[model samples]
Target: MAERIFIDTQSANAMIDNGSAYVIDSTLLQNENSRIKHFENRIRGAKYFSIAEIRDTSAPLSLAWPTFQQFTEAMIKIRLPNDGKAVIVYDQTGFGTAARGWAMLKYFGYPNVFILDGGLPKWVAEGRPTETGEYELNFTDPVDWRQYLVTEHHEMRVLIDTVEQIVNQKNSGDNRFAIWDPRPPNMFQAGSIPTAVNLPASTFFNADKTIKSPEEVRELLQQHGLGGEVITSCMKGINASLGYALQKYSGNDHAHIYTGSFEEWKKLKG
Candidate 1:
């Protein structure tokens, strides 16, 4: 069986203390301010071991590159004067930035990664626990992952392409890919990529945002040609990540997300 992923905070804390699992706070990047403030106030001086701080700034290349290689290497270089410990993440919410980071780590071949459920809000609402303050760390290595690693937006293979790619390919007679847009019909914007079908992300989730039943999910995928090469995107990448999650959960194992998404589209348009 696949490993069970947990989202509850108390359960996460117990697992961490007992050394059974690592935890990730997969809240959105835009929402971190309030969450971290709560963590600082309520947790009775809880000291976080390993936390990922993701900010909302474009890199020199306009990607989330800061957390990709330099951040990981820093973690590796720092030998805390203490024994080995579990890594934890504290994420604020906006567009699943932290959650996406956790997924990226898993994609990079890390053995274990998990996101904090309900993030800081859920933790406070349950009256469970909290911690505070900015963390202090010193970097020793200046290695950059881009030197050895490259993330090709076009090469990811799982993302559904824009209408532009579809039209171009159709004109060229390649005709091998299909597009699926997971946004709501109204928000789908004016000119969908040619050959693209609509499949709003909302239909795949319950009112609470959890996934729907397998039959329903399968139906959606089947309507959109699930078995074919799949790529997904939304306004930024949040809806796309949810779409990617549903695709993977629904047995479309090869689904990919166009991380820059329509946000990139508008930039290119201008």
Candidate 2:
């Protein structure tokens, strides 16, 4: 078993005070583009923290499109002291963003990474300290992390054509084809790709935002009819990443995450 890759806000605070960590926020959940202004002043003279925003764009799923190399490059170029460990803190209900970011780091071959558990919502609710204003990032040369790339795994992606191929196989009487929808049952769009089972990503976490045990995850997979090559997706791509992590960690390597998800589906069919 690999190390537990997620932490809580208190644990994250301790890490900042003692160990090394990085803060990443997914732009999708942010109410305003100016939300970055919240952390500007507190991090002004800070030496160890680095912040970044992952842009969510509507595109076809392909590992070639958003390579792990690009993500690692951005992290490196920002030069937040690589004290051999990094942890990403997200907002309360935005668990998907931190999980997705942590998964990307692992996919790129970076070992020591973690996500701040409970996210920002829990942090504020618990009366934890927070900084305000926009944080500036100093551009610096990123270390060569090519050796840590996990982009070679074809199983990590499922594109539009892949779904078409799967549907074709199903029409040809291939019962092995299966789809796993990681959104709430209601959120599962009216017309789905073909043969997908609904398995909300929320199933993978408790109210406290910790990863469930392997047995628990396996049960959820079975309950949702997630056998064979499961294509996981949510509204966009964040929650689907959590679905991917749960499946992969539960010993299902054949699971592929559909990055475009419902967002791309509606656009293409419209």
- Identify the candidate with maximal lDDT: 2
Per-prediction TM-score: 0.61, 0.72
Per-model CA lDDT versus the true structure:
0.51, 0.60
Superposed Cα deviation of residue 212, candidate 2 (Å): 3.8
Off by over 4 Å in 1: 1-14, 29-68, 74-98, 116-127, 137-167, 170-176, 183-187, 190-198, 213-216, 224-227, 266-270
Error of 2 at 236 (Å): 2.6
Clashes of 2: 11
Using TM-score as the measure, the top candidate is 2
Clashes (backbone N, CA, C under 3 Å), per candidate, total 16, 11
Which consecutive 10 residues in model 2 have the weakest lDDT in total? 41-50
lDDT tens digits, residues 1-270, model 2? 434555666777766766466565532334643244334322212222222333322335322235554555555555533345664545435364555665555555555666666666666677766666443455664455643334344557788788777878988888686777777787786545566677777877888776677777777787767855788776666667777767776778678877677667667754
lDDT of 1 by residue, 1-270 (tens): 123222457876686667665444444434345445434553333333322333225542234323445544533443221122334443443123444555454444444455454455555666765555665434465554333342323333333345466547867886566556677798786644445567876676555343456667867788767645676766666556556655665666556666666666566643
